[model samples]
Target chain A: DARVTQTPRHKVTEMGQEVTMRCQPILGHNTVFWYRQTMMQGLELLAYFRNRAPLDDSGMPKDRFSAEMPDATLATLKIQPSEPRDSAVYFCASGSPRTGLMNTEAFFGQGTRLTVV
Target chain B: EDKVVQSPLSLVVHEGDTVTLNCSYEVTNFRSLLWYKQEKKAPTFLFMLTSSGIEKKSGRLSSILDKKELFSILNITATQTGDSAVYLCAVEGGGGSNYKLTFGKGTLLTVNP
Candidate 1:
């Protein structure tokens, strides 16, 4: 079946290390998004891309977090010098191009649970 | 700021019982409200409500939206163990931006046999 796919379903790292997570959006879809879910923050959008280009990333911390879609099928979110507070399940979602006021429904990946010591 | 809130953070019910999940939101340039069922892996799309007061149904699962009150409700009749999962509510905005969804904390449902 068609679905978004994420890599390294689980990850553990020490503080001050770098972490990278990858996502493969559904074939033919153009938009990709990265979100972090936690008990206190619920779900927060870190970044989104439209047609392999970065659209908005205001929710991401410039110092340590970065997201990119180097190609149409692949999107990646990376954290440099990760901190203990960065522990949470990171999800990658994909949507189609905007159609009128509504866009294609977003499909989520299995998500990668990260734990930083 | 856009925000979505889901009530009754959790619910417990037995088989054949009915339950209702509520979600309220405040968002600018409202587009649509969507419901998702998250089990073990990813969240799966359940329903998307746009028009107010129109009940959308699928088998035993149904949902309705209230645009005036900025809220929605999901109703599941005859709860089964398979229905035990976290239900999520999200709101999509119509602004020019690519489209950001404001999601609620989700309501966890537990069904006993």
Candidate 2:
């Protein structure tokens, strides 16, 4: 079955280090989303791309966090100078909404667990 | 701001019992409500409800939405230990960024044998 693949299932980094997480969306999906999950905040949307173009990234911290889709197959989220508060599970999801399709369900990857000390 | 709220932040029940999780939302130009199950990792899609009064079911798990009430309910009958997880509720609203989803805190459910 098709699934979204994420690399480096776990990561441990010191504060101020740069961390990069990668995702490979389902082959034919057109929409990809990046989310951060924390115990207190639950799941927060960081960014999303439709057709390989970023549709929104308002939820991300522009100063330190960046999300990009190098191509249809690869989407990346990078945090420069990571802080202790940045420790969380990062998830990537993809969905394909065809015409007349309502509320297309997003398929999520296993996620990358990042721990910043 | 778009907001989603889930009731009974946590619940514990014996196996074979039934449970109902509640989700309420306040959003502008509402689009749809979605349910997800999260274990130790990423949350997986469970159901998406758009129209009110339409019940969606998959085996022992079923859900329904109420547009007028601005809430939804997820029911699991004959619960199993494997069903222990956090149930997340998300709402999609229309407008400038219609594709974005607002999620609730989620209900943590534990099933004991």
Candidate 3:
């Protein structure tokens, strides 16, 4: 089946360490989104890209978090000098918007669970 | 900011029972509302409602939206243990947010046999 792929289903890191999550979106989808989920914050949109170009990343912390789509197929989210508050499940979703609107039918990958101690 | 709120943060029911999950939103320039079911892994697409008062159905699951009230409801009849999952509601559309999705804190459903 054509599904979004994520690497390292689980990751544990020490404080001040770096963590990177990779995602391979389903072929042919033109939009990719990165989200972080936590018990307190629920689901928060960190960043999103359309046609391999970033459209918005206002939700991400510029100092520590960065997201990029190197190509049409691969997207990455990185946290440099990760902190405990960054522990959460990060998800990657992709879809093709219908006409001029944002995609309502989005597909998500099995999230990457990160923990920092 | 566009916002979505789901009711009854969690619910528990027995097999064969009928249940309804609620989702309310406040978004500018509304385009569409979508529902998803998430198990232990990724969330899977369930339904997308664009028009007001139109119902979308598949198997034992169905959903309807209300543009006037800016809300939607998902109904599952004759629930099974396999239906135990988190139901998510997402809305797309807002000023400068046409390419972004705003999600709710899904409702967790637990069905026991």
Off by over 4 Å in 2: none
Candidate 1 residue-wise lDDT, B14-110, digit = tens: 9999999999999988888999999887889999888999999999999999999899999999999999999999998746865677789999999
Candidate 1 chain A: worst-modelled 10 consecutive residues by lDDT:
A96-105
State TM-scores per candidate.
0.95, 0.95, 0.95
Q: Is candidate 1 or candidate 2 better by DockQ?
A: 2
Ranking by DockQ: 2, 3, 1
Measure candidate 2: CA RMSD. Answer: 1.4
For residue B38, model 2's alpha carbon misses the true position, in angstroms, by 1.2
Cα lDDT of model 1 by residue, A1-117, tens digit: 999999999999999999999999999887788999987877898988878888789899999999988889899999998999999999999988446645557899999999999
What tens digits encode model 3's per-residue C-alpha lDDT throughout B15-35?
999999999999878878999
Model 2 lDDT tens row, B4-90 = 999899999999999999999999888889999999888899998899999999999999999999999999999999999999999
Comparison by lDDT, 1 against 2, better one: 2
lDDT score at residue A108, model 2, on the 0-100 scale: 93
lDDT of 3 by residue, A7-84 (tens): 889999999999999999999989899999997778899999988889889999999999999899899999998999
